[model samples]
Structure formats: structure tokens, C-alpha cells
Target: MEKPNLFSIATKELSQDAFITWLLQWADDKYKKENEHLCLLGKEFAKSLIKLDKKLNAENIKIAKVTAGRQWKNIDIWAEINDDYALIIEDKTQTGQHDEQLKRYKKIAENYYKGERKVICIYIKTGNECNSSLQYIQDNGWYIFSRSNFLAALKAFNTKNNIVEDFTSYLDNIEKETNSYQSKDKLKTWLAAQGFYLWLEKQVTDWNEWNYVANPSGGFLGFWYYFTACKKTKGAEIYIQLENRFDSGIDLCIKIGADWERTTEHLYKVYGILFEEAKKFNIEITKPKRFKAGAYSTVALVKNAFTTTSDEKLDLEKFLTVLTNTENLVAEAALKC
Candidate 1:
């Protein structure tokens, strides 16, 4: 049997406070190998200090103390180095730093240390949304440790302990998936996935035959690629809209837009052809809307093209297949137009 990684499991199951406490334990000198007075974590973290501000001295690396959550109004982390320097870290996992949060922590650290140490605040974030706090952090001369860099630092000074190694790998995987737009559980991640999808659209779609357009705003639920004016018939336009909805399964709406003309015949032909094409691939089409709002256009909704969940969970590999399939259908129908 494989060794189970409890540290990885705890990070997901345990509360933020507990996880922070665990990190605090590792940051202290007591966690280091026997007889090592030097704080291994403080030493590694101090390296980050030099990277953030070259003015800070990196030599004579001895962390006097490492503490967290006991004093100074629950400031996430506090480290005193060589009895004269302090590093205050505010670590965030799911949330971004609030306005003046880091600033407030800096003041608290300074007051607690009481002119005994030079202090600097560092914001350590795992999430990708921090645009709002960037200027504030910059103005306050605070440093930021993004997910990627933080993981890199952890990997560099690993203690060769199995638990620590597993935890590091867990964080590494999370950063990779989140940064690459592979996880769409959050709104920001979903938008990133859409941005990547738009890039794929530009690469695969022919501008002369298809005109690609994104949602007017990121707040919108969906966007589409439609046939150009030249390729569109007076009564119908071939298009595919990829929709993201919280209460509905993944939808790839293959629609035929039409004017006020008699388009029932065109609608029948297109719907039949689309239904047959979808059947060939075991994709069941539903929610047939023929002549919506008195317009001659028709819509055939294909559900579960990527996922069965109603949430904005995107499966990129399956989505690419759906996009290609929809594009082929639209292209085939365009030849008739």
C-alpha cells in the first residue's frame, strides 16, 4: 500500500486557523533537526526578504523567535531575526488581502516589538485575484509572495520529511492548475478559462467564414462564434454559443438565426441535420426552440458536452472536443447557405 499523505489531506479538511497553526509550528526553530539553534524556516524565509528588498542583510542568519496568532491581534505570522529584524507575514489561501490589512498588521508587529526590531510586512497569497491590493501593498513597501514563488521557496529548503514533501506537492499542484486555467470553480478561474477558450477560437476559426465575439462583459454568462455576414443566409445564421450557468449543465447551443421570413423549412432541415450529427456522437440534443420571439431562428441545446454539473466547472479537454464538433457542424451547414 502507498503511504497516505495526511498533511495534504489536513489542508483540505482542516480549518484555516488549524492550517496556519501547523505552518507556524514548522516555522519555529523547535521543528528543526536536533541541536540546530537556527530557525530553518526563518532562514529560508529571510532569503525571500533579500529578494524583496536588497537593502536587508542576509548574513548572520539567526531567527530569535517565530510566533503566530498568540499576540498582536491575530497577525498571521511574526518572526524576529537576530533580535533586530522582524518579518510579518499575512497569509491568504482563498481570500485576497483586504484594504489596509497588511498595513494594520505592520503597525501591530511594530508596536509589539517596540523599537526592538526593524519590521517588514509580507502578503502571502494563494489566490490569483489581488489587483485591488497591489497599489496599497506597493505604497506600504510590503512584499508579496505569489503561490508559484512560495511553493518554489518551500521546495528549495525541504527537510526531506515525507509530510512536508507531500504538503509541498499539494500546494504545487494547486498553483499549477489554478494558474493554467484548468480549475474553473471560482469566477476568476472561469474567466481565465474563457480567455484561453477565446485564444483557441482565434486559432481554429477562419475569420472569413466565422466571426468570433466574446461576452460584452465578463459578467455575462456566455459568448459565441457565428458565421460572418457573407456566410449567413438572409433567413438563418449558423452559430454556437458556449454558456456557463450555475443552475444548468454545460451547454453548447447550436443555433440557426433567422429573419421574419418563412423559415420553418430551413429550421426543420437544420434541426434534423444537427440532431443526426449529434446522435452519431451520442450527444443528445434538447430544448428545441423553433422560431423564438417570432424570429425565424431556431436553437438546439446540447447538454453535458463537458460536464453534468450545473456549476461553472469546466473540463477543458472535453470542451475542446465539443468546440471542434460544433465548429464542424456549423461549417457543414454553412456550405448549404
Candidate 2:
């Protein structure tokens, strides 16, 4: 019912390395209840324990343990606090394995008869020793704490209630800030690399003026040129003059559809919508600007460099159809759009 000696915790001399070894052994010997100590723990606690240790070092809090009320079958330790709270300590040694640990803790706490069970698992990982590892563990998600973090918790505040509030704030801040971050389009690039050809085939067929966004990782859009048609005139061999520039860039010049060219204003307004539409379908767009050769550059024949077309087909038709399909069966049939 009273606060214990703070001096002992302040002077608690235990090497982290030694403590980690002992703690692992303790989980098996003192902490284990059954045949295998199969409810494994380690690197996780090393991580969370670090936080607790730091908190202890700072004289903010101290680790307190009670082997539960000794009545429950599954639970081994009831460490944390009581009346009005209890932190359920589990070691999330592996990425997502700690799910069961917390589940079991909740199960024990149901019979705990000691107010609300504010549970947090301490995951000490000797293998990983940085925020990234902690983040990796978190991405897999188990409400686990790293050793350093657990120690940090101890150093900041001593009371169980204080620890709960502090830890809650810590996590809340992390979520508010860290949850939005992504891995620089790692998942997106992976998908693109996998089924890129199929995507290109699909994208090229769509007219209706759409955008095909390129993946930053795409080193020269390979396998995308087959489905694309180059700009052409009424009757001459209309070479792609600039292959690989627009949707229809090829290593060899070919008669492809014209590039979609729009005025700057129309381009911006339509671009956002088309861009969104393309993204929705995972279509990749080219950089710089793609225009019908007439708008920016002359549609000069690659071989002759003199012949020109009266009316060339632009590349936007398929995209427009996809965005707003008008039941053009021939374009659909030929391109397999």
C-alpha cells in the first residue's frame, strides 16, 4: 500500500548483456510453467527491457513483478501495476508470434480480479538493435515493446498509472507521425515488375485520353512497346520518328498512333483526372510531354525526313475509350483493349 525503496532501483547494477542471458534462462526456469516453455521470448524483451531499464536508470519507474495470484493455469508473471491498472508483459520474440502471448495475457487477466488490464508486451531483441527493427516488429504488429523502450518507460515515471499514460502517449505520437510513412513505393514497383507486360498491353489499348504513369524504378519501360501504335499519316510509312517517347516508343521505328496533345490549361485539368484514372488501373505514364508530332515536332518520315501525313491517328483514343468507352468494337478487337 506504500511506495518501496527507490534507491535500490536507482542503484540496480545489472549489465544488459548479463541480464539478457539471465532473463532468457528465467523465462524457462522461473517463468516457464509447462513442458517446453514453448511460449518463447527473447530479443523482444531485450528490446522492451531496454526501455524499462532506461526508465529505471532515470528513477522514473521500476520493474515490479508478482507471479499472478498463483491460481491461473496459463499465466506465469503479472508484472506491471495494479489498482486501477496492470500492464500485461509478454515477450514478442518473433515478428507476429506475440499475438498468442497477449491473447493469453488477456485470458489470465479476465480472472485477475484486479481492475482494468492495461497490457503491453516487452520484446527484447538482441538480433535487431535499431528503430528500423522495432518498426519491422511493429509493422507485423504485436503491441510489443523493445528493451530500451521498456527501460525508457521506467526512467520517465515510476507509478503504474503514470507508465500507462506515458506509454499510451508514446504510441499515440508514433501512430500519428509514423503510420503515414511508406517504403518509397516498394510494393508498387514489385507489382509493376511482375505483371508489367500485361499492364502495358491493357494500357495501350485504352484511348479516351488517359495517362500511364511510369514507375521510378522502371529502367526504360521494357515490354511496353508492343501494344502501342505509332503516329501515322494518310498513306506513307509513318515512322515513330521518336520511338520510346510516348506510349508507342520502340527500338525500331514503326507506324504508331499520334501523341495526345492538349493546350496547357486543358492538359492540366484533364491530366489530373486522367492521371488518377491511369493510377487506378496502374497504368504508367511517360515523362516530359507527349504530343501529336504536329503540335511540338513535325511528323517527318524517318527515312525520307520530308513526307508528312494529312491526318494522323493520335494515341489518346484507346485511353478515352477506357475512360469513356463508346463501344468501338474494332479498336477493342484489334488491340485487345
Leading candidate by lDDT:
1
Residue-wise lDDT of candidate 2 within 50-106, one digit each (tens)? 344332332333222222221134443344332222434333321333345545556
> Where does candidate 2 stray beyond 4 Å?
1-77, 80-87, 98-101, 116-143, 147-337
For residues 146-187, write the lDDT of model 1, one tens digit per residue.
Answer: 767767666665466554567666676665554554445442
- Candidate 1 TM-score over all chains jointly: 0.50
Q: lDDT values of the candidates?
A: 0.57, 0.32
Taking every candidate in turn, the Cα RMSD to the unseen true structure, in Å, is: 10.9, 20.0
Clashes of 2: 60
